[model samples]
Each structure stands twice: as C-alpha cells, then as structure tokens.
Target: MSAEHHPRDRRTARVGLVLFLLTAVLYVATAGYQRVHIDVLSADVGAWRIAATGEPSIDGLDTSSINRSRVDLFSTVHDGRTVIARSPGVVAAGVPAYALRQWVTDAGPDAEDFTTVPPTVTAALLTALSVLLMWGALLRLTTRRRATAAALVFALATPVWSVAADGMWTHTLTVLGVSGMAFGAARDRWLLVGLFGGIAVWGRPHMALVAAALALTCAWVRRRPGIVARVAAVGATLTAGASLWSYWLYGRWSPSGGYAPAPYLSRGAGAQYEFNQTLGGLLRNEAAMWLSLDRGILVWTPVVVVLLPLLVQTWRSQPAWTRALFLAGVGYTLFQGAVAPFHGGDGIYGYRHGLEFLACATPALVVATARVGRRTRVVLTVVIGVQLAAFSLGGVLNRPTLSFRHHWNDNAFVSGLRDVPLLWAWVAISVALVLLLSRMFLREGAREA
Candidate 1:
C-alpha cells in the first residue's frame, strides 16, 4: 500500500490540512490590507532573482526594488562582479512561490519595485504548514486537545507567529525544517528524519546542530547497523552538497555564506564583541532574553514558562532517545546564544532565533502537559489568555512599524514602550501575574507529586 493510504498517514494529512487553513487565515487577517514592505527579502529574493534570470550579478537590479541595504546584505563586489552573500537554501525555497506569482500576476522581475505582500503571504502559509507538521508530531505523544493546544501555542502565542507570519526571513524556513524533523522522528521514519535534518541545515547552517542531534538519537535508539549507516550517509551527503554550493558561489565553504567573515570571532571587533565573547556576558544575555520585558521570549509568551517544569517532568519519564531528540533545542540555544549578535535577533518581536528551539521543544511540552493536574491546566490557561491580550495590545501599539526591517535599534516593541508610558505599566502587571500563576502551578505540581 502507498504511504498516503495508511490510516495513520491519512489522519495526519487531514489534521495538517485543517491546521494549515486555520493558521493561514489568522495570518492574513492579522497582516491587514496594507502593502507592507519587507526589508529582509532583499537577500533571499534578490538571490532568487539572480538565480531565476540566470544572472550572475544583481548590479542592475533596481536599487529601490530591493531593501535599501541590498548591496550590503545580499551581494558583495567580488573581483568587479557582484556575488550573492547569503546561503542559497532560502532563495531556493522561494522559487516555486516566485514562479507562481509570475505565472498568475503576469509580473516581470522589476528588482527596484518588489512588493512585500505576495512573498510575505507565501512565507506565512509556509509557516502555517510548519505548525501543522509540529501538531502532527505532538499527536504521537499526547491527547488531541493537548496536542492542538501545543500547536496553537507554537503558532500564535509565541514569537514564531509574529516573525514568521510577517516576511520571508530564513527563520520561517528553519521552523518548517525543524518541525518536519520532529514529525519524522515521531513516526520513526529514519530516512525522512535524515532528509528533514538535511533541509534544516540547508536553510540555516547552524541548524546542523539540530540535525546531528536528531541523527545521533535515531541511531542510538534503533541500534541497527543498516539504519545508522543510511542516516549518516544521507545526512553527510546533503550537508556536504550545501557546503560545496557555498564554496562554488562565494569561493568559501562557510555555511553562512561570505557576507561577513569571522562573525563568530568577536575578538578585537569592539567592546560589544569583546563583552559578548565572555562567559559572564553570555549568561547575562541569556537571562535577559528569557526574563527582560523589552525583548524576552517569556515576556511575549508567558505560556511558555510552563515548559521549564514540564521539561523537568518529561525528562524523567521519557526514554533516552526521546530525551536526546528534545535536547536538540537546548544544544541549538546554547550555540545561538554564544555567537548571536549583541542585540539578539537585532530588535525583532522577541528573540527570533529562539523560535527554532521552541519549535523543536514543542513535542516534549505536549507530552509533558498530557497528564498534568487540573491546577496546572488552569494556570496554563490563564497564562495563555494573558499572552493573547498582551499580543493584541502590542499589535495596536506597534502597528505602524512591525516588519522585517524594524529590529535592534529600530525595534517596534521598544518604540512602543517609549511612546506609551502606560504600556510599561501594563507589561509590569502582566509579568507579575504570570509569575504568580507560575508559582502557584509549580507548588500545586509539587504537592500532587
């Protein structure tokens, strides 16, 4: 029988379809009707333009058609010819969408006047599909309601929603790749797992950590020589292919492309780099990313705070292979935090890079919540409710400048806090409420235990 004809596969497909439709509608509604411009697309889309048209250089592409800093981010002057500085994975991902846009809209490649709505909508749909993949994976380990809730949290209550729904950033593709790997692991399909892991690394080189972690976990779990060899061989081939492509394009084998050399080497760069390289600075930034109201992950999605306790409980109950799979998120987090830029995601909604970790960790969270007590559930409900309200209010406050370009110094959340003093007061109150509820939930769990 074909794979799609399998009862489990059919049910998974139906669930995925429903989730994809729901998330796509929500994203379109939230985006409103504005013809928003996305700045990050310059690198991904510009590269797409070059590849699609068989042009080696983006020099004559209209300057206004791309992001203002297209030259700096997308391409560089290499021996008098322009060369794309970004990895090709994301650009390749956009090819089908770009082709469809051209076929349906009768649009020509006008590099100077690229619109954001079409590509942004395409990316949002892709992100919705990722949520579906994550939801399907969670179902293997939890009840239907709990799996749905986890998927919803990953899609709406977290930074993944805001960042991935907005534009064609590499992070959206990374989420899809991570979630696909999770789904493959849940189904015990080692080949699928290896393929998704390879795709993740193709999208973002750092994701190799996630891929390697998953590959090792599967090999250890099955303990079959044939499976282990197949997974290793496939993964190595895909990753090596990507590296070779990078070398061919930029004369370098770096996974991040040749945009900015020695990005991880902070030594002698400046005081910021010097501080970021220190262990003390790394820990400080990690704390700030989780707890600080300005751009912390928990600040935007207090519901995720439950994951800490859930992780502890789940770790004890889950098998060693399962634990290793979940730890991919932890490994990715440490790697990203250690080498991330000074501002951490440069002023997006929350810690955008962390969204990939959150995606990988969602299945474990679903399992953890499956058998929780009533008190824990109540606290989680309250936390989710509060997060929804906070995000709604933030949408109103930062409506005008909520796109890919607004990061770091130009972050919309920071600007909202500065413009509206009352927003800070509201945030403080919300933070306190979440903390109190979390404490209550932990105490209740402890008592029950």
Candidate 2:
C-alpha cells in the first residue's frame, strides 16, 4: 500500500494474472460432466430460459440434452410442472457464461444445450480469481516469496483443483467467499469481510454460520462495535436478498427450499435430515475428514501438513480477527461434517467439506511458510508429487469411477494409479519435477531472506 511496496506489488499482480490465465485454461480443459452435468447444465437452462422467457419452469423444453431424469429426486421437485432445480447462486452465477456461450455459438433462443466448454467455466474462473486473492492475503502476513509459494500450492496441489474446479459445485463458490474473507480479515477490513461472509452463505445455505462467526469474532476481537455494525449491515442486506430469491424460486421461506423429499418439516422431513447429531457419526466423520485416505483433506492436500507444526505459533502471532477467522473455519468444518451424508458421496477425489477450513487457515499457513526447513520442503514436495500424480489420473484426466461404481471406501487416487499405466509414468516424472522445483524454491527463499 505504501510507496516502498508499490513496484513489488505491481509485479505480484502481473504474476497473479499470468497464473490466473494458466489456471483457467487447465480448469476448463480438464472439466467434464461425468455424473454432475445437471448441476451446471440446469443453471444454463435456467439462465437462458429466464433471458428468453418470463417463466422459471422449463415445462415445454426438451431437457434430454442434460440427461435430466424424467423424475429425479434431489435435483428437482414437481409442483405442477418440473423445475430445473438448482441453488439460487448457482443459477445466477452462470448467467454471464450462458450468455457468452450463446453469443459465440450463435445459438438461437430455443437451444437447450450449452457446450464446447461446459457452463461450469463460471465456477472455474471464480476459483482462479480466488488464487490471486489468496496471494494478496499471504502478502498481508508474510513476504512475497512465501506468499507465491503458498498460493501456487493452493492452486495446483489442493482441492481447488481436484474438487472445486472439477465442476460447478458449491465448493467453487464457497472457496471464493472464504478466500475473500481471508483477504479482508487479514487487514481488518471489516466491511469486506462481512460482504464476502454474506456471499459465502449464498454458495451454501449451511454456511450462514461462517458470516455469523466473522461478525461476532470481529466485534469481540477488535472491540470496534461501530465498524462491526457496518459489517453486519452489508452482510444482512445480501442475506435478505438471497432469502427473497429463494422464496421467489422455491415458494418457501426455508433455505433448503423444495429440495427435501417431504413437503414440510412437520410431516417427517426431519427424519431425512439429522438435526439431532449422532455422537458416533460426528466423531467418526470428523476424524475421517482429516485422517482417512479415502477423502481426507490432508491426503488430498498434504501441503497443509506444514501448517500443523506452525498453527500454535502463528495463532499467537496473528491478530484477533485473523485468529477468529481460523476458529470460524474450525466450527464450520465440524458442523458440516456432523450433518453431511456419511463420508460425503462417493463422487469426488478429496473432501469438499474441508475446503473452508483450508481457506481460513491461509493466514496461519502464510505466517508458517517462512519457518519450514529445506528438508521439510523436499519432503512436502514428495508428498505433493504423489498427490498431483494421483489427482491428475483420478480427477482431471478421468473421473473417479472406481469409487462411484464400487464404494466410497475406495481411494480414487489409488484406483487411478492401479488401473492406469500412464499414471505410473506421471508419478515417476512429476515426483522428480516437484523435487527440482522444491530446490529452486529453497534457493529463492534463502536469497530473499
């Protein structure tokens, strides 16, 4: 912000832009519908339909292009006619891409399929921007050199690539929101934190607690009630707006809308959902989220291992708002893990539920990046090397069908390696490359220090 940092900051911005383009291309290229086409496909249909017609329901259109089931259970609900059910944010977010796809393809208003690049590109671009914002967040608490290293790991080696970038899932929007929170909270920009906090809820309704955590923690830590009040005002406006949108689309005040199987909570819909948390389910699921190879956050993102040793020190080192942000991530993870379907569905490579925790930990991780030893760097590189090879084989280059067709207990990365000979080669080459890069990073960090 000062004159002393202007040149370097601009350089960092340029570097981030380059990374943005590179990441976007990879994300879009590797994206495939697999079993999740309807997720974003419905969004495109909804946005396009809204543009051409006033009606929200796709009653007359042929929806076979997206392979939408004639009577799918969760994705849609029947009132009088079938609706292409999706979260309000998901539908709204894809409007620009749907428009662009239509313009470039010269498609008519009647067209239902949006393709060439899947409409999920909206999620991809947003996730890429989060990487740049992550770099900025790191710079707030650490040197540029450390910030770049951590941001690169975030982009390439984390679930931002394997899970969020795979499709237009909630993880895409949720990561973006939390990344904004990290950027704002690190600098005590209460309003920015609050604004993104509200947006995070739109990404996933359960994430309402995230904004609540940030607001209350900021109030408690900074003890600036007036500024925190501004945070609440901005966040409340967005929250109210999203609720209105939900009601208009879903015809109910409930955030879950018509997604539930039952008509209402009074009629046994509560049985389908678990408000009464099982102690065993909570303990088992939460532990598995961090420790299990099948869908553990650490397994997919071993780079976070470095943060473990530094959490306490960095917790002491960071400001109150930052610490509060990380604690909020902890609470978010626990609550989500408690209520989510066991071990998450058997569709993805890593644990999508753990993303916010990783995002919120950025400040502590950035502070800790400076302290990691060279041996630890190479060792972490080795862990990441195997992870990249596994993810590329299982997640990007192909879908995680082994888990889907068989069971969630199966590790998609391991299955990818076992079934594909090419992945063995990928592991051989990538491990060497990451090791070489680790040495270069070590030298650069030493010179900068």
Candidate 3:
C-alpha cells in the first residue's frame, strides 16, 4: 500500500512535526541561554563563514579577534597556507544561515564579534527535522506512541541533544542525512534514500559505510534493482564533485586534507604500532569505548545497555532491511573505534564519534523494544530516565572541550553528579515522571491487547 493511504503514516508525520518543533524550540532556547556564538565547538561554522565570504584560505586572516585556539582546527594547505581541512559539504550547508547572519549584522561575514546564532540555530533545526524523519521511520514498524517515545529518547537522552544544538558540526549534518536515508529506505523512496545517503557521505567520508549498507540492503535483501543504480549515481556524482574541490584546495584529491598528520598517523606510532601488534588491541579499544567509565558509551547513556538486550530479543522478528540497518550502525561504530585517529571524537561529550550510529539505529531499537514485556519496558524507562539525567546535568555543568579529563575524573558519574544537589533533585523528579509515564503506557498497551 502507498504511504499516503496508510493512516499510521499520516499520524506519524503529524507527531513528527510536533516533535520537530519542540526540538527546535528547545535548542534555540538553550543556545540563547548559553549566549552561543562561533566557538571551538563550532569552529567549522566559523571556517565556513569565512569561506562563504570568498576566501578559500584563512592563512592571513586575522583570527586574533576570535578564539586563537579555533585556528588550530583548520588544516595547512600544501602551499603552507591555512585552510579549513574538513569537507566543504558542511560549509555549503551553512551558506543560507551565513547569508542571513550577514544581512542581520549589515556587515561583512568577516566582521569581528559576528554572531553565529543564525548558523547554530539552523543546525539545530536541521537536527530536529532529522529526528522527525527518524521518528517517522520508526512509526512504520511500531505504534505511534512507541515511535514518539523513541524520538524523545533520541532528542533528550542522547548526545544528539548536546552536539547538534551546539553548532554546525559535521556530525550534525551527517545525522540529518543519515536519518533521512533511513526514513526514505523505510518507505521505499529509493531516490531520496540515495540522495540523503550521498549527502551523508559528502558530509563525512566514514559515513560511506552507512550509505553502502543502505544501498546494498535495498539491492540484495529487499531485491530492489533500481536502488543500486540510484545510489551509485548519486554517490559517484557527489564524490566526484567533492574530489574536484579537494584537488583545487590541496593539490591532491584528499577529502581529509584538514586532519593533519593524516588519520592513520595522527594517533602517533605508539598506538598504531601497538594496534598492529595484534587484532586484540583493536578489540580492546572497542571494548574500552563501551566500558570505560571516563567516556564509555554505556557510562554516558545507560539506556542503551538495556536496549541491547531488547534489540537482540526482537532480531528474528525484524524486517530484513531493519536488520541490515542495525548491522550498519554496529559496523560504523566498530569501524570508528578501530580505525579513526580520534576514537572518542576528542572535544565532545559522550562518545560523539558514535552519534551517527546511535541516532540512526534508534528506529530499529524502538521497533525491537515495542513488544517487550511491561516489566522490561519499565526497566527501560528508568534507564532512559537516568540517561536523560546524566545528559542534562553534564551538559549544564561540564566544560565543553575536546578532552574531558580536565573537568571529569575516572568516575564521571561521581564527578558530574556529586556536588550538584539541585541536579540530583532534578534526577529524582525525572525518574518519578518516567515511572509514571511507563505505567500509563503499559496500561494503555494492555488495554489494546
């Protein structure tokens, strides 16, 4: 049946719109409260703004007015001139906002103390829209309420909240693209699936794994012939365009020209040499990524720990495409941990490198947990409460930086929550509310059953 004829699809889109608006408002309010501007967290936004002003290289641009440390984020071109080393897709994405900021300020995009509000808020809106798309995808396989719940968890309990709301980081755009790809795939919108997938790859080369997985799933698992051709066409076109731009900027067709020392060498010979000692070292890093309290995945969002079991339980019942998407998330996470130079994503909170997987696989997780027993659902709710508490408190208290060691200790839980009595009170309230909601939902589900 067509999506237009499905009542669930209509409801899902409506709920998605509400969630999107709520997310946008929350992000904008937070940005305002924080008095956000182009800071280190959004150095790329600043770089893009400069690029929008027609300056290809920031080599001689006076950055003294801005945070000098942000300049370090850019890459030195082959000619020894400093340039934004990251992909231009993000810069291109922010052009509309940059233009708006210029008009608002009535000054050059390079004006000192120029506000980053436009681009930052634009990024947040994009993220909210992505979350909406993810919710719509979840709705295809689960109840509307369950899909709404998943969207809430994604927007509130995950790093998606902190990271996307902060600025136009590459991950922010990548999440939007990935979520759109998943939504399109769920609805058999092959063209949109390929389009968003290609956009994601353009935003972050590593996301090619996700794009390829989606394309292959449609072609092999779903047996959709046209999907492969569409994906390849879009992917090839974007990659070729990006390559040409890279050649112009770096004199080589390298997309990662900005990440100096190259990804492989960035971690230095000690780590690379030790990792080559055996595959064990790579596995150890992956384990550490999930188990290390300092920056571990579960340590930051314990709800995911609960979701894992639920996901495994519902594996057999899931659609082949959903299963493929879940594997894609796992593959991307493993790939990032094993190969990426910055395993933890350096400056963000809570395994930012894994945000794409976490956000993209959320629909699969919601579907997996939809039929879980009441007790299990209650437990999941509590875990989500704790995750929300941690994310909320940490976002407010922790210093936003590349390294957390300075502000967080070996035990992030203790360090983050120890001294904040008000935050503890908030956590108590949040848990109680979660339990009440869980009971209501379980009762409602029982009545329907």
Name the top TM-score candidate: 2
Candidate 3 residue 17 Cα shift, in angstroms, is 2.0
List, residue by residue over 239-329, the lDDT tens digit for candidate 3. Answer: 6776676676667775543443254534455553355235676677677666665566667777777778888888888876677777898
lDDT score of residue 87 within candidate 1: 60
The TM-score measured for candidate 1 stands at: 0.80
Off by over 4 Å in 1: 1-13, 28-39, 68-73, 104-106, 225-227, 259-261, 269-272, 319-321, 345-347, 392-449
**Whole-model Cα lDDT of every candidate shown, in order:** 0.64, 0.68, 0.67
Q: On residues 221-332, what C-alpha lDDT tens digit does candidate 2 reach at each position? A: 6677765687778777777877776677777654443344243122234554453246665577677777777777776677677567866666677776567767888888
Error of 2 at 268 (Å): 7.1
Lowest lDDT 10-residue stretch of candidate 3? 32-41
Q: What is the TM-score of each candidate against the true structure?
A: 0.80, 0.87, 0.86
